[model samples]
Target: MSVLSATDVRRNWSQFNDDIVREGPQFVKRNRDEWVAMSTEQLKAAFSNFTFHAHLVQEDDGTITATLDQFDLVENGSSEKEVLEALTYELIEYSQEYMENFKLYFHSPNRKAHFPYILNVVAQDHPENVRQLITCQAGVK
Candidate 1:
């Protein structure tokens, strides 16, 4: 609940950073804008509950297809591993695009709910880390 002015934070950047590391997060207000500063670890923990759930199906041709339940994305490959890799790649790209146009995507009604999931994806340092967050289940289709 403690909010510091932007000037104070700028003047004590080192202390501000140290405080965030020790206290978890720090809030700063500048003009009409308010921002929270926290470590990447904190960000990851905040969205850890968010996950990507996918439905998997084996195609008639023997390929495996995965469709994400949370996002409008699908991928197919020769094996489950390959399909998961492809889907994860697509998710990463989508998350990055969503962030690049945050205002547009965040304001949309349907996409608003995607914020936490996008944050979870962004919190990951690598594609493999993101991949581990996804859970897959077999689908009839």
Candidate 2:
């Protein structure tokens, strides 16, 4: 509710940043445009409750396949570990591409709901961290 003018934010940029770090997100208004400033940690924490739900299948060939419940992304590998790593990499790549084409993706009916999951992936910033969030359930082969 405490929105600061763009000019005031620019004039006290350092203090504004400090305030955000100490007090969480801050809102700023500029000529019909509104923005919220917060640290990466805050952003990550905001989406911490989101998780990647995946279905895992053991192929007859002894390989493993994982398919995410939230997105149309799948990965196959020789082992569960390899599959998880590959899936994490795919997620990071997808999240980056989603942000790169945010407007297009955000407007798409099927993709709009993916925002929180994408943010969760982006916030991790590493494949290992992302891997930790994936919860896999057994799937009938």
Candidate 3:
């Protein structure tokens, strides 16, 4: 769904883990020893094959809300880090709808030409059918 931080996985271990208990299979190093999180299916699908972008906002009361640029999805949390973690599930749950935006993106010549290189592509470009994309989240609130 979305890339997660090693801190995100550490802070919420259970949420990052699952029945498939293979180490490092669901993570990619960000820098040093820090890692970015992903689902098994996401891994097989090649997380790097697609680009996904997000927008984070700090609300009036200090809560943070993260929204995917490609989707009409919003996730709230106490911090930017937390919002990012929550974005993992927000993406999967709203995947189908989010993908619809691609249709629009490709339809408009200007939009398609100006599409950011950071947005994730749909399964068509990916071609690999990820059978199990586990939904995960954390205590971002």
Candidate 4:
């Protein structure tokens, strides 16, 4: 899990996003003291939560906190959005693993039975994003 300050969040949004999917969750510091978290899925939910810091946890009295799962919940729609967000995150994460790094943890025989179909879908949907990520890492156009 990577940690970013509010300023870091603004300056390195894409890298921060890569970290979220590459890792699992990220912490964002506010006012340089308090912390909040956004999940890999939450960042892609960017389409939904256009508000910066929208994923921060809110207390009964509405205070921001560092909790993660709370921030990943989808509002203002049916569960389909949540399902789609989860699928998108999985697509990005596994495509990075399989396409860029050549890692095949998901392809292990024991795991293959459960993950094969999902892996196939990710391969189909995210090859371009995977290519772009690799190109960026390689300093190529």
The top-ranked prediction according to lDDT is 1
lDDT of 3 by residue, 7-39 (tens): 666677785676224444455345566454545
Flag regions of model 1 displaced more than 4 Å.
Answer: none
* Model 2 spans > 4 angstroms off: none
- Lowest lDDT 10-mer window, candidate 3? 127-136
Clashing pairs in 1: none
RMSD of each: 1.5, 1.4, 16.6, 20.9
Q: Which stretches in model 4 have alpha-carbon errors above 4 Å?
A: 40-141
Residue 133 alpha-carbon offset, candidate 2, angstroms: 1.4
Q: How good is model 3 by TM-score?
A: 0.37
- TM-scores, each model vs. reference: 0.94, 0.94, 0.37, 0.25
| Candidate 3: pairs in clash | 51-119, 51-120
Candidate 4 C-alpha lDDT tens digits along 1-141? 456688878898888777767766677777758665556355444423221112323345433322112123222212333433443454456545555443464556543443433333343435443222221011111
Per-residue error for 114 in candidate 2, Å, reads 0.9
* lDDT for model 2: 0.91
- Residue 125, model 3, lDDT: 36
